[model samples]
Target: MSQNDALHGDDLEKSGEALIEFIKSSNAESVLRGARGKLQEFFDHHIKTKKTTTDILNDLVHAEEGIGQKLVNLEGKKSQMMQEIEEIEQELQRNLSRSQILDSELEFLQKELERLRDAEQEIQTMQQEVDQDTTEVIPSAIYVAQLYCNVTKIKLELDTEPHILRGVYYGGDVAVPINMDTSTRSPCEVSDELWSLVNTEW
Candidate 1:
């Protein structure tokens, strides 16, 4: 090979080995990172020098900065999402507390409703007894008159008169008569003492 060609080959080999070392090292400054990109551009320029190696290196450096900025933005989004989740969890706890209070009130209301139902059943039984004692029906007027005899402390008597029937009817026609005593008596007079005793009773 010519001396110039040999010297260029040695420079390429040294640049390649330096680039491998830079990539392996964890400590890379922005300038050194840009230099690493410039090495790839330098290789491409040696093959075909349409664009300058420096311009390609600067573009790659800007792209890396953009990627880092996007990572920071994603981290911010993750923090916001975590905060929202915490707020929702707090709301759920508040709702659970309200539900527990409502459950307690519902249980109390159910017990009260059951007590009212029992009271209503008892009232219905008492009303039925009052109705049974107050009213009665009689089969005939004679039976009705007999009931007043027990209540008013007066006796009632009936009189009968017989008449012969002509051929218009085959039986004798009898006239029924009733007598009522002028004097009547009731069980008790209207009095405050009697009303007081009735009102205080169950």
Candidate 2:
């Protein structure tokens, strides 16, 4: 209020009469409780279609509290989500490593198969040459005996061989000792007649 608005005494009679007349015409209420707000056009302010801070439910404060709880929940789950992502990354890396190893193994196997096919073709060609020329043979009696022993072993393991060793074909089953060396049998162990026959045939 201005100095004249709070005129007190008959000493300022004219100012006091003017203030009193203004208060009577205004009919303003006395402020007995808390503080009073500044005068303004209050109707123009709240006449619009919008809620203020003092709305019925205090909705702004409630919404703030709700958002705070949601933020706390999100923060709590962040580490768990990060751990799950790491686990997925590790699994993907492990599978990729295994796939690379499998691809390498398959590549090596294909190359080895091609090499084995070439070796087989070379062996067949050499065998045909040896069959055509008997003079080209390397004659070793010990080698012949070892070859015979190996043939016998292969026939035994085949299980469907109608012909095994020469004399042990359809008769008694020959049981070989497990620990003995089958290739160690010398050509001298054979009878003289069989040795002569082998020398002539071979």
Candidate 3:
């Protein structure tokens, strides 16, 4: 029984009857004394055991609470990590999209460059053909005639004796005169190829 029950309950009457029996019976005194000593030892050990059990139970409860708090903290950290992972995935997708756009732009620029190179090659080929045609058009005879007339006019103007060449013509165009007085001169004669060179655009 608990200490409170032994002090306040019907244990008092039972305790008195046991004391009377112990005095009336022969050789019961020594046996009762020994039993009382043993009972006291039992109560002392029980109380010690109960206190130790209570302390252990309290320690277990505190340990459980600590473990619960740690679990909650771990769950929060896991949630934050998941959120970070999601953000990283989104950033990677954005980078991939930008890379695709750059690839498309690069492809377009490459096509434009190829087209420009082709056009430049065509223009160079056409220019070469025009140059070849121009080289074949001017005749050597027309070039010599123009040069002879130009030299004769320069010599005539620089000569101190102008009267000595008034009636004679040494070097001049047979059809078109080198002088500005060309009223009585014939029309200039030129090769058909030279005429095309002076008149044609290409």
Candidate 4:
């Protein structure tokens, strides 16, 4: 209950009468001054609250601008990173293509080398066969002379098996074997007279 509500009967009447008397005796200037002071306090409190609100709004605006700038920078970086990733991917593709081409070239080279090796082996085998045949059938000196006469078109005389000569002749009725060293001589070491005789006969 209020204090006014607690008062009753003569107490309420006396309080009412005293309040009326106080109101009548109060100075007009003092009453106006008191109201002005209260109004000033209320306006001061309102202005202070409005200034705090304006400061908070300014701070919020600055924070928003900072966040926007940061977002723009991050976006730029993201774009750059994306472009780099694309470049790297393109480079990887090119390298893979080059590697594939190199692999194909290597495969072709390896096949060519194998074919050449096979051809070389065939040639060696044929050469060995020819050598074996030549070893088995030795040519006679008369056959060799006939061959030189046919190929070189020169009437060359040669001895049997061992001492084959180009131009020298040993006149005998019967076959007499002469014991001499049968080593082969280079054409460069042969006498010029022999070569001249062969050319003249030809």
| Reference-based TM-score of each model | 0.35, 0.36, 0.45, 0.49
What's the lDDT for all of these models? 0.59, 0.55, 0.62, 0.66
Which numbered prediction scores highest in lDDT against the true structure? 4
For candidate 4, the lDDT comes to: 0.66
Candidate with the larger lDDT of 1 and 3: 3
* Model 2 lDDT tens row, 136-163: 5566654444344433332123243333
Off by over 4 Å in 3: 1-25, 122-202
lDDT (tens digit, per residue) of candidate 4 on 1-202:
7766767756978999998888779886688889999999999999999999999999999999999999999999999999999999999999999999999989987886786676567656655665577655545655545444443344543444555543332222333333323365555544443333332211
Better of 3 and 4 by TM-score: 4
Better of 1 and 2 by lDDT: 1
TM-score quality measure for candidate 1: 0.35
Model 2's alpha-carbon lDDT is: 0.55
Error of 4 at 157 (Å): 35
Model 4 TM-score on a 0 to 1 scale: 0.49
Q: What is the C-alpha lDDT profile of model 1 across 23-112, one tens digit per residue? A: 777466666878989987888777675456667888999999999999999999999999999999999999999999999989877876
lDDT of 3 by residue, 1-202 (tens): 9989877666778778888886777677888899999999999999999999999999999999999999999999999999999999999999999999999989977886786576567656655665577756647555444443333322223343532222223333332222333233333432232222221111
